[model samples]
Target: MPEAVAVDPVCVAGVDGCKAGWVAVFRWVGSNRASEVQIFPHFADLLASEHEPRKIAVDMPIGLPQRIGSNGRGPEKAVRPLLGMRQSTVFSIPARAAIYCEDYREACSAALAHSTPPKKVSKQAFHIFPKIREIDQLMTPELETRVYEVHPEVAFWRLNGQEPIAIPKKVKGSSYPAGLDARRDLLVQFGFVANFLDQKPPKGAARDDLMDAAVNAVIAERLLNGDAEPFPTDFGRDERGLRMAIWA
Candidate 1:
């Protein structure tokens, strides 16, 4: 790889899994392009190898939003409602909404009965209250903090171009209309810009593909709309520093 470029406030992605494991970094090029500039195997590696990112907009929920209870006990509860749980954001995506409900439900069930893939305890109970109580009871602040989660659906939109929601016929009620092609374009755009920031592309050039565009969206949001939270210059001491930069 060539010498790393000078992109500030790089956009990053971190995943936890066997094959599906990677952290992507991005930066903006000129006015028309954003790219997935860099790829790392893990967050630790990224932190150690690359510069400190300005604002890492993850693909997972940072907070579960303290739940509210009818009684007066501070906030109701801070639990991720079963999968398919819905949140009313200005830019809501049906597919994402449905997944929240489904994912939380599945995650909740797994927590209950000790191990996941719950036994055939009771079909009716599973449908009704089922595993929610257990899930609600289990979610703690520490666990939430330790875990890295962001709604890919939201990231997809922010990175792709912040398209409007228009559910598809098949996934009409709880699905997104944006297809693979559009998503790919967005990713590629992000990758190019990210590479530009890093000043060098990856070996295979596969990892940076989506991140480049994602990072661009992040920077675009910052410069155009001032959406992201700003980090101080001191935040850049250890790492490469945030990917924030002035392209246009």
Candidate 2:
């Protein structure tokens, strides 16, 4: 007699930060199809709404550092080799003291004082400080265990058979995104419909935001199944006690 295949329902989400708010993708475990995808202005709103998932995988750095130098955090260091050409996507997080600075000068000063080698905050890293600070404050230890930090590139790399995609995310000649169709195609192989990519992103939500969030949601399912793994296995905690690790 043939063995029976088991089916069970699982609910999880992936979230990405965007201009106006955040984009999220929600789906059931072991299925390619998404239950829903939407954008929310605040993480709190997302949590309060009916779309809440049992676990949320987000494309943001959760556990922050008290200090750093030329090298980034353990999880960030761990992903670059696996990502190859796309490794530049992993921006190092600034010191915890840098998150509250009012301006670039203040941030630079804070970084130098707080970091081990007296580092300065990168313009790019500083750009996301608002989001990082927001999540840092919102995530109390009690509420944070359910939220996992994930990198979309790492998730997609795993989806693409552990090989990094050669193409850049944006168009060669223009800033508009390319390879979205191809990404959506790869996602379809996982069980989502091609039309899943057709959902018009909210104003200020870039196309990549939707794709990034969707990939996060997919990885959340992987985490539930125990298929996902954390980087650097050796994780540390911030002053507030939020763990610093990334899952893929």
Candidate 3:
């Protein structure tokens, strides 16, 4: 790879895993126009070739635990009640060991071995295992300090003045609308440039992916500004010492 060019110092970013790899949104401080909104095939490639933002909020769980509670981690547990009807969007991150398993059967077996009560590995979580493991392996002390875990719904709820949006992101009828416009409107009001949301999503970037990434960028801004809130202020770290808190 060529030498990475430096990005704006005031830039903040959000990343969402996409079918093609990752979709990201970058925004500079004090302006509505986004610096970038695109997809990259690998998380590391995105960071290396793309302009480096000061902080990046990503819609992925970090800090996998060996054991799970009745409801899961405090941050994961806290979100369901807060999201109300839209809670299922959040997938539980399984034990760190389960991520290394190659198949669902192996993953399930591994989950049981690692947890006291044993956890059933979901097909959804299994599908994202590759992406999760990618982040888990790539994270280091220096990178962990800059990148953080965030949930789109949590970030959106926070953006809607601490209220969840009434519309579901993936609507069942009428072209399967993801209510991207509704989210865009709210984000615009929150301070994003109006035109950025108007841009068509690139190929393989689902509407939800774009919206999710955008909110994460906003969270990055609030995080540095000391205005963001973390779930389960009392949190723990992963085996490698990665923080388990979810910021919104």
On lDDT, the stronger of 1 and 2 is 2
TM-score of each: 0.37, 0.90, 0.89
Clashes of 3: 1
- Judging by lDDT, tell me the better candidate of 1 and 3: 3
Q: Candidate 1's residue-wise lDDT over 1-39, tens digit each?
A: 899885544333332111223335444323343433455
How many Å off is the CA of 156 in candidate 2?
0.9
For residues 1-248, write the lDDT of model 2, one tens digit per residue. 99998886667989999988778888877555546877788888877768557789998898777787667677889888999988987987778789888698899999888877777888878888888888888897887757999998898998999987766677643334456776777888877777877678778788788888888887888888888888878887778888888898
lDDT of 3 by residue, 7-124 (tens): 5457778999988899988877855554688898998886774567778898888888877766776678877788887788788767887888988999999887876577778887
Clashing pairs in 3: 32-193
**Stretches > 4 Å off in candidate 3:** 1-9, 31-33, 172-178
Model 1 RMSD vs true structure: 12.8
lDDT of 2: 0.81
Model 1 TM-score, all chains together: 0.37
- Per-model lDDT: 0.32, 0.81, 0.81
